[model samples]
Target: MGDIRRRWTVTARARSDRGPNGLSLLPWLLMGMGALSHLIQGDAPNPVIGGLGLFTFNTLYIAIVVRAFSPCHRETPLTWGLLTALAALTFALAIGYGREWLLLFPLLGLAVGAVVRRRKRLGRITVPLVLAVGVVTFWRDGWNSFGVVYGTFISVMVTAAILALDETVRQLRATREELARTAVEKERLRFSRDLHDLLGHTLSVVVVKSEAARRLAPHDIDAALAQVADIESVGRQALTEIREAVTGYREGSLATELDRARDALSSGGIEPVVRQSGPPLEPRTEALLSWVVRESATNTLRHSGATRCEIKVGGTPERVRLTVTDNGRGGDAATAGSGLKGLRERVAAAGGTLDSGPAPRGGFRVTAELPVETQASQEWETTG
Candidate 1:
């Protein structure tokens, strides 16, 4: 809920930072008030012509500037055409009536900046436009009018830079949101896999031990009682593991899982052959391999009607390999299970590969090869 509120606030802030709009450009229209005042005073000749020119420039300026703020219309030929017409009107008026009419050049620059974003294009337009503004201002107002030229230059460059910055900020925000969503999905996948692996193995062990106890209960009460006691121990360990899995801190040990696998296989009446020979592994790698061991043993007990199972773990300094094979009728149930699929995802994420198929001798085989320095974590995904 807090995260949701934070996201909402960020969205609101982003909206508020949306830069200038069409309405914001309206205030620059006030710059034409000087010409309006001169016309009202009736101090100039050809009053009707001057009034028409001023009205036309203002109309074009408003239309072009407003369109410049809209992404859809900013690049259309119509917008460029309107801007061109406004530039022609501004230069004619500045040359015709010296003082206040020349102020429209900076407004023209602002419109150009808003519409053209690419630096190369903006440079081409501004350099020529600035040269024209300087020449016209010199002819009409004189050499002291350098301020007009400088103002036009600053207006164009600064407005373009600001709008470009706003665009970049918006892109960055979109990227951040996408990354956050990906993180949440990864964590969800990790939790689901952990739960499936923990429960799948634990339930398989419980089912096997229950069957063993039921068979021994009739004649060997002591043996049956021992089996029941083992069930209680398995149950308690499962409870602890479930708590750890929930908290996302559970780490599996290869040696511990191998011992449990032997017990589970023996209870299911399958001879277990376990072997390990490798340099000490990183905790992350061992945790990954332990999950493989647990899932394989569960499948062997529940799916393989085999009399024997062989589990081998061997590695060099750079790579490690694990193979679980059972002398059963291909153990199709193991290959079809979600547990292997999930393990595959975890291993692949850690830069490893997992393969499951029938062994050459006509039994099911599960093989996994990982870099010795694997970075796979315990909370990684498992399908089942």
Candidate 2:
């Protein structure tokens, strides 16, 4: 969940970085121009009513256009009221004067297309409603009124198409944002796993060797001195590994990590048992399994008060699996620490799954499964 929140934060920052140039009011300006042209050229029998009608129409048109561009697509009651008033005024102008006034009906269609909340409902209600108004107003003129029909048809079709194109662009932008977020998340997981694997293993070795030196200080000076020397050596090696990890050049192998886990567990006075029965794995699979071993060992040493730990590896022609279990004091696996969380993301990115929970008998268990031939798994194996 922290990882997810970080990704969203990065995405928001990226959008903000693009600045004010991302949006422009030019399209609305063009729409206003086209709508205003109707009022200037349109015929008005009763100047007062016609002028008032044009003003209301233009005001409603602006409101509808603004709402269409809003992130939310749903219409409010105020919008419905505006549309209803516009329609009534358009109808009055058409009936009192001439069908030329009916041309304004097309603007109403455009407004309907822009302002309606639901698409399916818009298709069912708005389209038929607009068509009916156009037909009823022009029915007296017969087939000779081609201008009225063409104008109405063009207005509705063009406006609806524009709205659809706008919607498509919105969906594309959203998809692009999701992809960016995923990429950021994957990179963060990689860095976290590298740091945890490096430091956790090194620190566990240092702690164990330090304890041994303290215990042996009086019994045998030579043994105590040797343990101190070993601790120094381990600490220096950890420093080098930390540097490599930070520079993103460190890599782990399953065989090496397993050996290291055995040494760390033995130093901590815990028995280590490892079992393996797998076909040869690709380097990527080996690397991922290595990190799993490293993290599990660290957890057992730091948190699990266990006496024995078991690491198992097995594979079939189709998939490979790794499991780490310990006879430790178990806790809620759902609330795993950052190391396990990073492991989950790493495994998932490789087309694999990781499951951790209380073992059926006792203690805690972590399992990872990776397909033998997925593209993502193959890519991870090669690069990981």
88-205, model 1: which lDDT tens digit per residue? 8888888888787778888888888888888899999999999999999988889777888998998899888887777677778888989999989988888888888899899999
What overall lDDT, based on C-alpha atoms, would model 1 receive against the true structure?
0.86
Instruction: Give the C-alpha miss distance for residue 21 in model 1, angstroms.
Output: 3.1
Query: Which lDDT tens digits does candidate 2 get at residues 71-124?
Result: 553366776777778777766666665545566666666666666535577678
lDDT of each: 0.86, 0.72
Where does the lowest 10-residue lDDT sum fall in candidate 2?
A: 375-384
Using all chains and alpha carbons, the TM-scores for the candidates as numbered come to 0.84, 0.65
